[model samples]
Target: MSESRSGYILLGLSALLAFSYLMAGWGLPVEYPGTVALKASGILLLAVYAARRNAYLLAMALALSAIGDAMLALGPSRMTLGIASFGLAHILYAWIFLRVLRLRGMRGGMGYAMAGLLAVFGVAILIWLQPGMGELRVPATIYNGIIMVMAIIACLSKARWLAVIGALLFVASDSLIALDLFKDYDPAWRGPAVWISYVAAQFCLTLGLIRERP
Candidate 1:
């Protein structure tokens, strides 16, 4: 009925969908096309919530993320599309963090150190995955570089701790995906692990963007 009520309802539904999808992924034997929609549904709801809050950039980022989820779920044929979608989303996220940096005026040396560490980590990851990336190498490298910069700026911006945590979680999730896909590190736990980190990352980033002033 009221705005606050609707917000709560949407968040509750999103949480429910996320939990249900996680359980289904862990227990279910078969995945249909519908599963793509199911995987993206919770994040889509969060995107709607962001739009209602007038966080247009975050909303667009979330929507792109949802599209990426669907593309990835569609199988290897759509992998490029999935990477591109998520790559764009990361660019938007970096823009948001850059805005925060503008507002804050670059105060801390610690942030620079952290960002440097992240850059090093990104380079190492790229080196490891480069051998197996093949035709996708260039695009995947660009995407990896973008996300690493996003996470680094998120830290440097110092906008909100939740956003920082979300950025880190995102890095963890994507790193796992790359490792599994390119480095042949597939394990039974990879799917659920990636999903949990990704869902948590999106939820935190959404709330962080909504609540953050800078």
Candidate 2:
């Protein structure tokens, strides 16, 4: 199929997933089948689109994200496994973003500027959540580092702004997760923000790859 047609189909799937989440009341314990399915399906569709276009880096990233969602949806007890899954996903995404930066030619000051911004925010957040991080501190720190790398490389992408936006959304979603898991923050708001930002991030990343064509 044409990229345009396939992109629309993916968009429809994203809308369906979001619509289903609303119908499901958007509550906590996002382990339900419907929620998990929605969470995975949209990104999975994007993976398929990437595969069709032979964009393996983007495809692998989305596939890992879908797996991470399923692992998380298994329940609270599986949070560790979910974290590991997402950690790997972030690593893969970082690789793709870095590759893109090299291929696109670095933006000199702008590139370093974005990386600095991401690093500062990442370090600050990790410090803020350190006390409660406790046993999971190591894993959380590594994950945050990987994601920060992805976010920084994304900023180096001038034309594929969709990917940049998606990377930032991914960072935001993880931040909400950190707050929800560590700090005694607002669950009511955090819950929805997590899912929405996640789904939107995947959508943007996938569509951005489709538009970029490689």
Candidate 3:
């Protein structure tokens, strides 16, 4: 089969796994050993696709995301490691958006305003979660700030709507996780919501960056 055909197949398989995982719940208690692989499989598939397409940076980021998923699924003890993996992934994503993909000319005042708004949003979120962060406060703050910077860079990419949307979805997904983890707002829908948004975000970011002029 051609790369296109294979890519689609991988994506289909990923969607299937994501759907199955959702149906089975997040498998929070490690129902089985396969649970970790099942949780990570979707993004791992995407990482494979990215690697095949020669998007090494994107592949690395996706691979890290898969690892993060697996680590988080293992238990609460691995949460810090999971967050660190994701933080590094976001840093890679920001680099890709700012350097690799050329979207549009950055506007002067508008650019500064947009970045300022994102910074404010990140700080606000950090403040809200500060009370509950306790020992994780500094890590959470750094992660939050990095993700927001990633989103800001994506937005300033101007015409690259795919990257912008992906970054925002990623931010939204992380925000839900923060609420579920740090705040007193752990809704039943939070798990599925985070996974769905995160999957879509990664898909968009990968596809967008891969399509950019190399």
Candidate 4:
């Protein structure tokens, strides 16, 4: 089979595994295994196909994200590991954004401003519900901040508009997850929106990097 065909196959299998895990519901060991398999396969494909510096960086970010997913599958008893893994993933994402910014000769002023504003707004809302969501305030705040920063950086980068839009959608996905976890807002729309946006974000970023390759 052609490399492109293999890439697509890997990508498809990864998506299938992730979807299977998502549908497996809470309190199931199968979910974690499926998620881990999906993520590992996804990252392996991405790394093999990534042909540029930016693409490689994005692949690294995704790999870190996979680590976070695996940690989450370890269940709430290992919540600290999950959170730390995601936190490190965000740091990797930050590095990716910074590299893009440097390549495009873009400053981070706008991104910083946007992130600050969103952080304030999100924190305010979280604080208002602190009596109920007190345990989640800190983690939610950190996650939101990372997302906002990522979106802003994506917007300012020289990458394709699709990539920027994908980044925004990713932010929306994570925001929904946080809301569901913290505020009991488990809207049925959250699952599809989150996964679709996430996959799109990865695809767009990958394509953008490929296009920019020398």
Candidate 5:
């Protein structure tokens, strides 16, 4: 296989490991070691694919994500730290998406239309269920709205199906997690779906990056 393909395969493996670790209830401390390995490996592979563009930025984003994962697994005591890490990761992702959008040029009205629709749906659902959401309702709703916008913006930047799907899946995964936080859900099933979708989203996104013109 070509080196590019090999890099994707390695990234896929790293994502798989992350999913497995989450499923096993390894928590932050136990999961940190494995996540560190996976993230480092993923960064290395992506570095090979980087050619004088936004590669370093992408690597930094993944590294931030890894740190967030570790903080989350470590336990509840580090919730603030975990949120901070993940927040930075999201910012990094936003930057990368912005770069991609600039390179591809902004899409016209259709893109904005799609984003507006997503926002409407997201906000409507949140509003309808606000009472049930309690403390998490507002924050979850706001975050989802931002992410949906980001997803749409990311999609508009490129025609790659992988990138679009990845962005959508990310929205789905986070939405599920928010629902779980606010309401009662079957943890056994919900947990796996969330992590699996999360991993898939990341894989699709990174793959899209690798496929971009250097």
Candidate 6:
């Protein structure tokens, strides 16, 4: 096989490891060390792919996400740290997406449309989870706003389809976690739901960014 194909194979393996370990936590009851290691592996591999392409911002975002994954998997005590890490990652992603938009120059109407959608989407989420977000209301709202802006930027940029999908999936992943944290959900659904969306989100963004110019 060609080198590119082999590299993809390696990245796929890391993502698979992450998924497997996350599942093990839900089913196999894996220990923290093993789970966190595997969880971070997938994102770290994506960072490597970004590095290979010299996509510096994308690499930094992925690397920060990997750190968040590790922090989160370590357990409840470290949740705040994990959130902070992922928050930074989202900011970096927003930077990358906005830069892409500036360079590509979206059509006039499209920018307004994206902004409206971002506002509507972010407000709707805050409304839906408002009661549950009590103490977390402010931070959650801010983070939601950030990611929504990232999604909006992606929607208006050249890589609209891929970036949009990836951004939304990332939102879904975090939303599930938020649900589990503040509201009631089927206990069994928690782990699978979070990891599935999270992993897929990273995969989409990483692959999409790799395919496009830096």
What is the descending lDDT order? 1, 3, 6, 2, 5, 4
Q: Tens digits of per-residue lDDT for model 1 on 97-203?
A: 88988987553887888788899999998998899998899889999999999999998986778888899999999999998889889899998899999999999
How many backbone clashes can be found in candidate 2? 0
RMSD, model 4, all Cα superposed?
Answer: 4.3
Best by lDDT: 1
Q: What are the lDDT scores of the predictions, listed in order?
A: 0.90, 0.77, 0.84, 0.62, 0.64, 0.80
- Ten-residue stretch with the least lDDT total in model 1: 25-34
Report clash pairs, candidate 5: 27-73, 28-73, 28-74, 29-74
Model 5 Cα lDDT, one tens digit per residue, 1-107: 97657756666666555655564564545455565454345434444444323567666666666676666656667655755665666666666777778888876
Give lDDT tens digits, candidate 2, residues 140-204: 88888888887887787653778788999999999998897789787567777788898888878
TM-score of 3: 0.91
lDDT of residue 3 for candidate 4: 73
Whole-model lDDT for model 5 versus the true structure? Answer: 0.64
Global local distance difference test of model 3: 0.84
Give residue 140's lDDT in candidate 3 (0 to 100).
Answer: 85
Off by over 4 Å in 4: 22-44, 51-54, 107-133, 210-214
